[model samples]
Target chain A: MQWLTIYKKECLESARNYKWVWVPLVFILFCIMDPLTTYYLPQILESTGGLPDGATFDIPTPPAANVFMMSISQINTLGVLVIALITMGTIAGERKSGVAELILVKPVSYTAYVTAKWAAHVTLVLLSIFVGLIASWYYVQLLFGDVSFIHALSTAGFYGLYIIFVISISLFMNTWTKTPGLVLFLTISIIMILNLVTSVFSHLLEWSPTNITSYLPSLLRTGEVGQDLWLASLFTIVTIVLLLFGAIQTLKRKEIV
Target chain B: MIQLKNLTKTFDKQYAVKNITFNLPSGKCVALLGPNGAGKTTTLKMIAGLMHPTSGQVELANGVKGDIRKYIGYLPQHPQFHSWMTGMEFLHYVARLSHIPKHESQKLAEQLLDRVGIADAKNRKISKYSGGMKQRLGIAQAMIHKPSVLLLDEPVSALDPIGRRDVLNLMEELKQETTLLYSTHILGDAEEASDEILLMHKGAIVESGSLQDVKERHQVDKITLRFDGNMKAYKEKMEEFPFVTHTDIQKQKIHVYVQNVPEARDVLLELVSKEQWPLLFFEVGQTTLEDLFMKVVNEHAMADHL
Candidate 1:
């Protein structure tokens, strides 16, 4: 019961943060970007005094889902950045700012305090993803016409988990240092490193949730859960669990000095 | 009630607090008094459950120790709040942390803001509140749930005279229900507000008990003497006077606190005649709190110097 009070307070605070607003706005903008680029590039080239040669072939019809598909990369970039930025302060900011001393004076332990904080970040990321999905739905319906609800929901769900995974990684990152910026950087840098490694070294990167960002959406594309299923499942579950456990343990032993 | 038995806390292989033993009976206010860096805050933190003692244990006299935590409200020295929150919001958060229901948390939050004298700025962020206002809010947050034990660490530091008066009054007001123990560097504030004073020095409570008792035990013989001319000759003459332990001369005045003040009176008069030190005033009295503090601090320094 008491935990719910803290959770509610945290949720309200997340709502007030501007990053929550920026997440959906940026992602929605990114989602519409590919379609706009596809629609205009041919015209732009033709206007440039016709291809400069007699042999100019027509551009292939890109898939109507290209705009929505671009959301994958968007999620890995802006989504991960937003996740880290929002959750960087999950524990370290409070500890560094000395607010932990104020809050811990009550019956609230460091465990409950940090758990509620991460819960807030998760809720924010989830809400932002939901907002982005609504905007995507509007744009896809207007531009592509009739996106499968299953595709949209599954894609949104996968991205939601990815965002949570990013935020959780940040919460774990907090234990290493007490700076919110540094912790957030570590979260983004780790995700980016894994992403780069998987793209360049397929055999080396197949061990973890390397393809979850790219492959999770493939589940939506095919309406089946085959894209990096084993790796994504293992990585998402293990990363979240390990990170949350690490966050809880680090916070539990945190000294307010 | 709160009892700490052999409570000692060590940090980085050094004892930050050692052999702390005391009991705070319910409904009484005890002051943990000390100078800067005296481990007063450490002892308070240990009692507040913010830090664990390396040795021994703290026992609540009435309820189970764990249960007692539910009834404890702590105010840190530089009380920190969520900077983005209003005084009302901060109080509400604390209310909820204290397990008040959502409805009651909001309701009590308003009432507490009023009680702490910040109801006017209930919607403004805490970062914008004045220091005195912030300190009051800190106190308000601590007492919001009406905890049974209120441990305030330098609760009145940032308060002005009127604010200090109000906070002290609030503490007195809370005495009917809560066991209050606070630490402060402000000796006068402690003297004015506390029934008992725990004088901490070198990570240990060197002196404690009723304020009057501590003062009485450490009282020095005091003499205020006024002379017409410079007190230089008189000061030098009184240094050799029988029973005169020490003397400090300031202009035409001589301030002396001696071991045998009664015996020094006649010698003082004789010195006035011999040295032609024109006397304007001569008086004797008991030591004040400031005198006791200086004596205790200097004695410790002298002992360590040896």
Candidate 2:
């Protein structure tokens, strides 16, 4: 695609400046902190056992899966917020900074620009999730025995899709709003709307973007790709298409004054 | 060549750009001059394909297919960039949008960042960059693709003198590779940089030509001579002549306005023969850009007033 140049550039920048240097440092620190906190929480709870149902602890025996899951929560789990922050800067920040006018003038169409943004964001998000997962995997092995590794890897696939879906949704929100604060607020509002609506219609809503929000948790809860997994995938794809199309059109047609 | 034929851009019932026909040839800069809301930017946007003209075609030269955008570099009135991106990242992202290969995007982006003089600050996040720095990065991103037509709308309005000079110099440098279509009300800039001026007033081109050619429109040979007696009769008589456009009698002086002063002088010499009037002063005033602008605006305003 015409957007590949921008996409690759985004990947390199994100890798070098965004996570390659930042996430691992943060995650490694969390790696220590996560286990240390988990390890000591039980003792702390036991010491404070005199309190009525206070300081009750459910600390996991430092297993690979537990460390990995904790690491995922610490690093990759900011998926929504991180992706939202990244996407908001893509279109909204550019527009606000007045760089859009300059770029749009150069033989780049609104479609190509928007698509490039979508692709760059998706690539970054996927990389972030994968890198964090891999890091967690490494730490998990260091912490617990290899036996704790999820024997069925299908769950990871479902989780990967779910996280990517969250990223796509975040990018879509970024495109819709150029203000970071607004996108942040909008992302939360959208997630809340989807979650609230889907929860109300729990078993009925199949093709809702919000359902994809649970795709990761669902895989963790149920090892198989349930109705929610397929439904979430479907919802994410459809919404991504529609939102990206709208973003492209808006970008192409709007004057960058 | 960029030909906008009858390019009408209407918002609601108010026609922002009404039946605009203009030709921007390759390798020539066309300065779009107008007051606020005169539709200069709208017309430029239509050419840049940022806004679709309500009714008309923005046809590019040589029938370039699949969106003429590849051939165009547009610097909007206000440039924007991804906040999370550095000045360098902004260019990189634009390189991707331009279809530059992944392997080459970084080199090209770095090159552009250097070209725009933001190389030192390239690593700084765009949100942290200054307005002029952001604009420089904006220019870098727009030029990264080396497009054929560069559309710069008020490209220097935000910059300080140095930034403006850099941007202007960059424009001059870019002209070696691409045509520059700049839009601004700053007549001095139009005079300094543009090969031609497209004067827009009231949603239409009141004048379009080389600066000199446009200045010719308001060129007038004016002379005033005092009559021995009342000059009202002479003023009245001068107006009757087809050659005399405007004649006024103020106190004892008779003022005569003519297209060709020398020829009008010859005619006035004949008038001297017929009736004796004290010759006062004669001067030829060539039109300036400001004069042309005023003349066109006044003519249009008068027409509308009528």
State which candidate has the highest lDDT. 1
Docking level of model 1 = medium
Interface quality of candidate 1 as DockQ = 0.60
Which portions of model 1 show Cα errors greater than 4 Å? A18-20, A44-59, A65-67, A109-111, A137-147, A196-201, A204-207, B10-15, B54-56, B66-68, B226-237, B247-254, B278-281
- lDDT for B265 in candidate 1 is 69
Q: List the residue pairs that clash in candidate 1.
A: none
Give the TM-score (vs. native) of candidate 1: 0.89
Give the poorly placed runs of model 2, Cα more than 4 Å off.
A15-39, A45-79, A109-116, A126-147, A151-153, A206-257, B11-13, B78-146, B155-178, B192-195, B222-284, B299-306
- For candidate 1, the TM-score of chain A alone versus the native chain A is 0.85
How is the predicted docking of candidate 2 categorized under the CAPRI scheme? acceptable
TM per candidate comes to 0.89, 0.71
Candidate 1 lDDT, A49-153, residue by residue in tens: 668677867887555555576655666676677667767876678778777777876778556766677787777768767776667666666766666777778
In model 1, how large is the Cα lDDT of residue B71? 73
Instruction: RMSD for all candidates, in order, please.
Output: 3.2, 6.8
For candidate 1, the per-residue lDDT at A170 reads: 87
lDDT of 2 by residue, B1-306 (tens): 788889998889898999999889888877898877789888888887767878988888798654788877777676656667677767766777777876799999888888888789988888898889877876776687887788887888778999888988887788778888888887777888888899898889878888777766656666777756566776787887777877655556665767777778888788877775565654445445765675677678889899
